[model samples]
Target: MHDHARGLSSGAHRRPLAVSLALTAAVFAVQVAGAILTGSLALLADAAHMMTDAAALVVALFASTVAARPADERRTYGYQRAEVLGALVNGVVLIVLCVWIAVEAVGRLSAEAEAEIAGGWMLAVAAAGLVANLVAAWLLRHAQKQSMNVRGAYLEVLGDLLGSVAVIVASAVILLTGWTRADAIASLAIAVFIVPRAIGLLREVFSVLAESAPRGTAVADIRAHILGAPGVRDVHDVHVWQLTRGAPVFTAHVVVDREVLDGGGAAALLTNLQECLADHFDVAHSTFQFEAVGHEDRHNAHR
Candidate 1:
């Protein structure tokens, strides 16, 4: 028996991502203006990060729409993997954006002296950005857990939120103490926050693209669980993996006792294996290939 349930629906992420894109676009404009007016590296870095956020949100929205499509003859898995592709793109963007900020910030720090910036204006714009980022992050908090695409979007927003905080702090230091280098320092700090998040997202996205087992699942543990099923003598060719966030596919070949196969116990055994995977491993879609000892060997040996 094979239970083939579809992956989770990503319709829930559309609204939150739309709201985030609108707010992030607004912030990006404001931050760009602030960066230009004040010549603040911290503001510029935040602006750049927000630009990536806008792009990420757009990708996330597209992925959500396509992922909701039904399976077709040409593409039996539907469009669910679109979310992973979106996540991978977002992660790569984050990495590139962060590295760009780091290099620019380093140049500014190594200069003979920091350029004069309009500290007061920087402070006001950063304050506004901080508020907008907070709202965007909150909106996507719940959806992030349900979809990898949403989670990537949330990480972008969250990184920007931190960047905004750094900008505000740097702007205030420059305003009160006339320490202009604080701008570059804050830019570096923002890069620090962005790198780790980008790396984590990339690892997960790559894992999915590679069709590797999810980090949370252990193949050995699954094999053991299947072997423990009644009337199952051995298990082999066991494979467990996911296409995306919630669509797990498990396939295994089980070698059962000859007595069980001859006594019409095959149906009962199939039910038990399916139920085991569902109850213990949260694996909803599974295929069990049953065999009676030497029967499988001879059946395939001739082929």
Candidate 2:
């Protein structure tokens, strides 16, 4: 009744993700050392962010690997949802990191005596971190479009890149103006910028977990197209949802003219229906139950 079409595997993204992970890991160590020596809150916050980015990349890489496994009887859809779960975890972690950064920034701002930051040391380390983040971001840029898991990692690295820039600017301000609070202010700005993106990613993850139709996809529009198929009288109980990004599934009960079934045109009608979905909606996996008009009336249990 339905075509079996596997979701696109995440294997293609693994190499770039691995490279980015290495780059982030190396930058994290350097930034941590710099933060300790400079006593710069902004540098410390960026280091923490980089550490989390490395972890997120690891999770994304593992999830993508698991998601490439073939479907079996026990797990008919294979492990495509693993990518979404990975993305969900990354999104939550990002929000938590932001909260920590915000709280620390506030505490620093309220203190009677500000921490003495070595702006020259902070700026040197921050510039190095910025260059590393830029390379990682470029590596994952194209891959992010194909998988939510990769997108989550890409966003984290991009945030880290921005954080590095903020640290550099803060350090420059402190060096030139002797304003110690610039470090705290920069940390606050980085936290503020990351929270919204984390929220947006979480919203997308929840929508998938809820079995909602993919974004920009309208159920009403799908129903209209189904009704347009030759021999189809009406469609009911139509449903659409996604297993992951770019992997949509559809199902419906289609009422057709009795003559079409009796005259042995059912096969052609089914093909037309399936092809209509494939060509117009880009949905390759669909199921349809064909019944002669009024068959639902006899059952009396249709939704």
Candidate 3:
């Protein structure tokens, strides 16, 4: 059962990586052409977003492949950290693009360049982009639930979807009101939407790289739970962190009472402690050091 589940998850991860790459490639081509033909800031901004989408998809594909590599002597935890690194790179790139878009939008807003928008053609192309983005978003939604790397790619695609919608609205406004500033307004809105999301992703990836505890999992709570176990006299040196997006690891030194320590009851107590941690904290990887009274020197050495 475990093997089958792992196989299914592996296949699921690969499928989205492939689909996202292909979709982003196609979307980029369409967006580039739209930008050239319409001369619309909104279209240009969408194209920039599509470029990031392609880059993000490529990073996600690479990360997923690297993450499947087995642990080696040099990399005790394997290549799983590659996904966090990829997400960090993608987040930084998105922030750069957002800043560029914002700067360009502000310049254009001040000068108010009159866009030579081919209203019908612009609308048609934007509608096509909207449909493509929606389809890509749908294809990636399932995979996003399975991995954080996929989720980052999924969010980029969703951002592109909003950019497409903004372009369509800008085209409509230009057609109806002959107002060129609407295009710049749409571009500004797109930048506003993307920057905060990029910053949020950056923060999360940075936390993972720093080996900080996973969000919502408190160290003190874990310590309390371990100490609450019967026969446990004290708990110290408790460490908790994420091994991957959803996989958490924990380690600690647990001191048992002298009676429990001498009688082989310590092993069973440790097992119970492991179960309690798993049940309460959803921590699957746990390492507990059983200690007798007056063993601080040995415990310190082991640590």
Candidate 4:
């Protein structure tokens, strides 16, 4: 018997992404203008990060829309995994952007001639970016918990927030100490901060794509629960994995006493198993194959 229990769709996060995207676009423009005016590598790096954040939000928004599509014959599971793909792209883009920033910062650091930095304009622009990132981060904070796509955008915004702070600090150091190298140092700091988060996000996206069991779900405990159910003698061939961020799917084979089938209790047994999965494991979709004792011997022989 198989039971399909639906969960909330990804569409709920669209508004947050849209709003964040608008804010990010505006910030990116301001940062780019500031970078050009101040000749500050740190400001330019933050603008680059903001550009990626804007792109990530756009991808996340599109993925949420695609993921909300209904299942059909050709695509029985629908488009829920689109969010995972969106996250993957976001992670890759962030890492690539960081690599570019790191190389540029190194070149600036090695140059003998100090690049003149307009500290006042850089500080003002970075402060504006900090405020915008804070607002965008607040908007997506909750939705990020529900969707990986939103989480990717949220992470990008957070990186941008840190980048803004780094730029502000670099501007201050330049303004107060007249140290131009601080601008390159701050760009390197932003790159260092972002790479770990991007790698972590990629690791999660890969885990989901690989169909590994969702984190925190114990397969052994789930098996024990199934064995504890009434009229079940043994269980095997268990599998559990997630289709997306919060949707877990499960399957198992059960060996049942012959009396349960002969006495017309199979339906009740299936219902009990479904309820066990839904209630205890929070597994909304599950499939169980019931068989008489010694069936595994035959199944193994065939295998």
Q: 2 or 4: which has the higher lDDT?
A: 4
Can you write out model 2's per-residue Cα lDDT over 25-75, one digit (the tens) per residue?
A: 999999999999999989999999999999999999999999998889999
Ranked by TM-score, top first: 4, 2, 1, 3
lDDT of 1: 0.87
The Cα local distance difference test for each model comes to 0.87, 0.90, 0.78, 0.91
- Candidate 1 lDDT tens digits, 1-303: 687553345566798889889999998999999999999989999999999999999999999999988889999878888998999999999999988999998999999987899999999999999999999999999989878888998999999999999989998899899989999999999999989989998998888878788778888888888788888888777777777776778888888999999999999988887887888788857988888987664343311
Q: Which stretches of candidate 4 lie over 4 Å from their true place?
A: 6-8, 296-303
TM-scores, in order shown? 0.92, 0.94, 0.90, 0.94
lDDT computed for candidate 4: 0.91
Flag regions of model 1 displaced more than 4 Å: 5-9, 258-264, 297-303
lDDT winner, 3 or 4: 4
**Per lDDT, what order, best first?**
4, 2, 1, 3
- The RMSD of every model to the true structure, in order and in angstroms, is 2.6, 1.9, 3.4, 2.0
| Candidate 4 lDDT, 25-141, residue by residue in tens | 998999999999999989999999999999999999999999999889998878989999999999999999999999999999999999999999999999999999999999999
Candidate 4 lDDT trough over 10 residues, lowest sum: 294-303
After superposition on all CA atoms, how large is the RMSD of candidate 1?
2.6
